[model samples]
Target: MPELIILLLFMVAAGIVAVEIKDLLASVIALGAVGFTVAIGFIVLQAPDLAIVQIVIEILAVVFFVAVILKTTHVDSTIGRPYKGADIFTFIIFGVFALAFLYVGVRFLLINSSAGFEIAQHYIKHGLTETGAVNRVAAVILDYRALDTLGEATVLFTAVIGVLAVLRLEGRKK
Candidate 1:
């Protein structure tokens, strides 16, 4: 329990630092740290497979963030943007939501098992047969949740394209 709290604190601190830091590289590193901390949390939860996947995804994401930062002229676009009262208001609203979410999450995590345990068992037992996939994870992600996977891929592609466009515009200005 102590370890979980420590890891959760580390993750939360990393997330806050990632968002609050001005340097793009530092923010990216903090974000990576957040992901690493989350992977540790997964390990603590006895989910080694998820931990491995999280670590791999975190590494790839960090690399992509670094590449985008290096390709762009400026490290941050908000360097010159003036802060407004709306920003503070947004932060206050975000804080309220974060607190509420944290409370609900803690309450849920304290449960010995979730309500979806039976559903998960059913999926584990029948996923491959139903989806015609050899692996349960593959069946779940590629067949049952194919649209979600596609949407995630599309979002990633869009982010890359947007970064490229911004960099191109920055280069043209020079």
Candidate 2:
């Protein structure tokens, strides 16, 4: 229970930080932190494979984003801005939204869990018979779900190409 609470808190903090931070570098780091935190939660819940996948993909995304940030910009931001009433009001609104989302998320998670576990369990029992893969999740991704994986790869490729194109433009300008 305490572990779940900590995870929830991290999620909320990540959300707030991602939204509230003005620095691109800080926001990218926070995004990576959130992803790794979720991966840890997944591991604690007995999904090592899922945890690994999340960590890998998140790390990849962070690499891509950070690489782009490095190639495009470099600067430290000032933190000396005077606080305003609007900042406080916005933070309060964001806080309320986060709390509401947390409540709904926890409730739905508790309610909808068994149905999810049922599908996983079904795969565990009959996966070998149907797909001939020892790792059920791998079977889903590599065999039965190759289409989704292919789409994801294509997206990643496009992102990489986009990054390269932007960097190329920068080089040409110089």
Clashing pairs in 1: none
Q: Give the per-residue lDDT digits (tens) of candidate 1, residues 37-142.
A: 9999999998777899999999999998898788885266686577899998999999999999998987886683567576778888888679877666667788
Candidate 2, 111: how far from true, in Å?
Answer: 6.2
Model 2 misplaced stretches (Cα beyond 4 Å): 21-24, 71-121, 170-174
- Per-model lDDT: 0.86, 0.86
Whole-structure CA lDDT of model 1:
0.86
TM-scores across all candidates? 0.63, 0.63
Alpha-carbon RMSD, candidate 1 = 5.1
